[model samples]
Target: MRWSKALIPTHKEDPSDAETTSHKLMLRSGYIRKLTSGVYNYLPLGRRALLKVEAIVREEMDAVGCQEILMPVLSPSELWKETGRWDVYGKELWRVRDRNSREFALGPTHEEVVTDIVRNEVRSYRELPFTLYQIQTKFRDELRPRFGIVRSREFLMKDAYSFHRDEESLDETYKSICDAYTRIFERCSLTFRPVEAATGAIGGSHSHEFMVLSDTGESEIIVCECGYAATDERAEGAVDPHPCDEAPGEMERVDTPGMKTIEQVSEFLGIEPHKLVKTIIYEADGRTVAALVRGDREINEAKLSMALKADLVVPAPPDVIEKLTGAPVGFAGPVGLDGIDVIADHTVEPLVNVVVGGNAQDVHLKNVKPGRDFKVTAFHDIVLVRKGDRCARCGAELNSFRGIEVSQAFKLGTKYSSGMNATFLDEDGVAKPFIMGCYGLGVSRTVAAIIEQHNDKDGIVWPLSVAPFAVEILVVSMKSEECTTLADTLYTDLKTAGVEVLYDDRDDSAGVKFKDADLVGMPLRVTIGARGLKSGVVEARVRKTGEVSEIPVDDAVQGILHILETLR
Candidate 1:
């Protein structure tokens, strides 16, 4: 590709709405341009990089014995409705309708469509235990998409689904896919961790997310030195129960004014936040339930939903809370709460005296004791794990990191098969639901994450394996016929040698060419200038290391290829 003809529109200023490093760099580098909120148009350079990523993903998936297939981005509503996800997937499902008033959805994922294919085609266990993968576009109605393509509404994804006859087969394939994922990210030069994750909306028995470590990431992960890692929503750590050696104190209602938050109430009562119990009312599967936790902690809604065995769990609306507790939003309490289930965090079990809501305006209860003042229907670990918390596996203090989730693997078991009746006949002639697994790699997001981790102030430092071009031949002085001729000769030689090379043949100044080269960040750069030509050599620089070497004019192609090999 020639820079004079290519649409590499490098910019000097950042986009006004760009917040993260990746977003700002991508715009300035001319990789993508915003078409609308949460949507972008990939330019030539961006498309080339994306294709390389897709090629890597395809190779990895193929090496794992997975067959490639394509599915429609517009999926029928019947398939999602069959799995009960049409309503359960929430507003992000991108629901639509055809002219005939038939419903459809732009698929955020392909689990339902894949399951439909398997159920219709395969009927025997002999054809089971195979994986099908597709690299395609996916859509989601993101309420607030930010960070450029990292959280875009429309993006490229490589999603794979596997079907199995039994749990053992599913487990075997799951491990293989996870291993492939590790290799995929490593090949892209990403520093990441695979952490246990909650299977949100994508119903599954177990899942792990490949999180690229970055301070600008949107997801929070809890990590331990003992190899225990999980997304904060799925992390489990030891919590010490409140120590109470003294007898239970009598609960008393006290009045202040307008103390709604835990901080406000604790400040008004002159007590630490840990000394108070937070009563959080939620609508778990349409049943009103109150969850109790230490005021200093936060409720993990994923854990709460799992504990209640509910399909959905959301905080009750203000109106519902006011009607249930006879008070405003933050004043609900479990004391004397009637006609509802109450679940308490394990950290609150041993408390003898604590503060709680008074269930009335401008009121709070002090010295309230659990088991004496309110009844807890059950106790579970429902608090979000934090730094300094004890690890459940090794008893070490936990560490936390913000990360970008680039890929995720799920052991779906029979979540979709059971729901949609995707079954195969076994040797015993009994129909059994197919055990399934899902693996997804965010192709577009990985590109953004790579920039988030691999970039400096100059621009994106692309890994050679996924770089848009392996070598860039810059004619530093196009005005000099000698420099332009030498650059063209080297470009031809490299192209003939099967190198992915880009030629900056435009009549641009040395400074502009150098700046654009750094912004695009090719792996290797060969500078052919009049001064260098006079010296019988060309300047070669490695983008990542900034290592410069003088390559003899006669050996420019060979030297550039050698440097690219080392980059790989």
Candidate 2:
């Protein structure tokens, strides 16, 4: 592509509203333009890059057993209603009415629609283990869309769904998809990690998210030094149980004037925080519930909510606590009560002698045994494992890092199939719900995340696998016959050798052309300058390493081809 014909609207100054590195560089380099808060318009350069990404996706998907198909961006509300997502999807699902008053929606996802399509055709389990995929635009009404395409309301995505006959079959397909996703990201030349993920709104049994580690990532990863890594939501760790390992002393009563916080009470009585059990009131499922955990650990809300399977769970308000427990917030505990439903963290359940609230102001009861002193309906992990905890997989130290989810694969296990009656017949001719596994990659978000991971202080350093152009040939002095003629010859040769070359044949200074070439970040750069031309040579620069060398004009294409091959 020649600069004279190509739409290379390079900018020297950054846009005011571009907050992310990808958003800023993409606009400044003439890749994308923002139309609104969550909407964007892809210019010629941007469209080319997106097309390259799509091609990569298509190739990788086809390499696996996936057959590509195009799905509708607009879908009927009746499809969503069949799966009961019409009410559960909340505001993110864009709902509309047609001219005839028929309801429709711009699909945030296609699980409902895809399953609905297969339900009519899939009758036997012999048709199981089939995968279908698509690269299409998805819409979601993000209430606070920011960080450019990373959290946009409308974006491109690659979604694949698989049908299975049983749990083992689903497991096999899930592993295959995970492997395929790894290859896809690898082909895109992204530095990413596949971490365990929580299937929150999607409702799945097991899922893994491919996260490109970046500082600006939204998801936090709890890491361990000894190869132990997991997301905060799925983190299972080992923590000291309030340091009460030493034989706890006998139970006792303490009276104070006005100590509310655990620190205050521990300091006033000269006791360690590990010896006291903290009591909290949570209002869940329309009931005022009391939960007791150790004073040292904070509660994991995701863990607590999953244990109860409640629709809503939150800390009980101040006035509601006083009316239900006959005490203020901090001073409520289970001492003389054995009729209330209570749950404790696994580490907290083994405490034979621990201090707890005495249901009054500035009072505490020590030597509290969990099962002996207080009755409980369940004993499970109610608190989160903090930093300095054992790993769930290999028992290593747990560390933490925040990430943005680029893709996820889940084992749906008939969650939607049963709900929508999408079943298949077995060999015995009995109808049974089809098991499912779903996978998705956010194409636009991946673009933003690649920039987040691979950019430097100057600008984005696009990888060869996804870069629209493999080499940028800049005529340093376009008006000079030697430079322009040599640049034109090199561009044609590189293109003939199957290299995607961008030729800057405009009348520009060496500095301006070099700066624009660097901003565009093709893997290889060829500079035809007067000094190099006189020496029968040209300057070749590596965009990623900023390494430049003088090479003979005849060897320019070969040298660049070698670099591009290595980078890809």
Candidate 3:
């Protein structure tokens, strides 16, 4: 590729709206352009990088005996309706109507479509164990899309689904795909961790997310020194039941005018937040319940849903609170409550005397004992884990870092197969739903995450396996015949040797050529200047390490080939 005929529109200044490093460098380096709020146009350079990522994913998926196929992006609503997701998918699923008034949707995932395919073809257990995959674009209408391709509404993904007849067979395939995902991310030179995750809205039994560590990432991950790591939603940590050893005192009622929040009461009483108990009212399947946690901690909705064994749990309405506690919304408590269930955190039972709401407006109870003053139905672990929390495994202080999700593997069991009637006859001549697994890799987001981890102040530093081009030949003085002839000869020789080379043959200044080369961030750069030609050598620089080595003019191609091999 020659610079004169390429669409590498390098710019010096960053865009005004760019917030993250990948977003700014991608635009300044001419890799992508914004088409809309959460949509983008991938230029030639960006497309090349995305293709490389897809190729790696294909190789790994194929190696695991998973066959590749293409599925339609537009799917009929009947498929989703059968699984009860047509109404449960909420606002993110884009619904449209055709000329005949038939409803359809742009798929964010292909579980319903794939399940319907297997239901029509497979009848007996003979064809029970198989996997099919696809690499295609997906659409999801994000409410507030930001951070460039990291959270785009439409992007490319590699999704695979497997069918099995028994739990043992499903477990075997699940482990194999998890190993394959580890290799795929390792080959791309990413610093990532595979953490346990909650299968949100997918209704799976178990799942693990592959996350790349970066400060610009949106997801928070917890890591312990004993090799225990997980996302915040699924992280389990130990809470000290006896956080303090204070003597019990008699309960007293105090008038607190306009002080309903924990912060206000803590300030007015000159007490620490952990010394107070925070009670929240929630409606779980129309049953009003009060959840108790320490004042410093927040509620984990995922854990709460699991504890209550309900489909969904939301905040109780204002009227429901008043009816249950005889007070307004923020003044509900577990003490002296009636006609409702109480779920308390494990840490709340150890406190001798704590502050709580008085079940009446403009009043609070101080020095209230748990067993003496109030009672709870049950205790569970429902506190959201944060940094500095003790590890449940080793009791060491847990650390946290921000990361981007690159891949995920799930043990889906029979969630989709049972719902969609994808059943087959077993050897015993009994009909049963197929056991299943799902694996996915974000093809476009991997490119953005690579830039997030491997970049400097200058620009992107692409890894050798996923770089757009292997080498770039820069001509220092395009007007000088010596520099032009030498650069052209090296370009031809490198191309003949089967190297991905980009030649700067345009009549541009030396500064502009150098700046553009750095912006594009090819692994190897060969500079042919008039001064270096006099010494029978050219300057070769490594983009990642900034190491410059002088190579003889005759050994330019051989030197570049050796460097490329070492990088891999």
Model 2, C-alpha of 371: deviation from truth (Å): 6.3
Tens digit per residue, CA lDDT, model 1, 388-445: 8999999999999999999999999999999999999998999999999999999999
- The number of the candidate with the highest lDDT is 1
The lowest-lDDT stretch of 10 consecutive residues in candidate 1 is: 239-248
Q: Please give each candidate's TM-score.
A: 0.98, 0.86, 0.94
Ranking by TM-score: 1, 3, 2
Q: What is the lDDT of residue 207 in candidate 2?
A: 86
Q: CA lDDT, every prediction? A: 0.91, 0.82, 0.88
Backbone clashes per model, in order?
0, 6, 0
- Name the runs in model 1 displaced over 4 angstroms: none
| Candidate with the greatest TM-score versus the true structure | 1
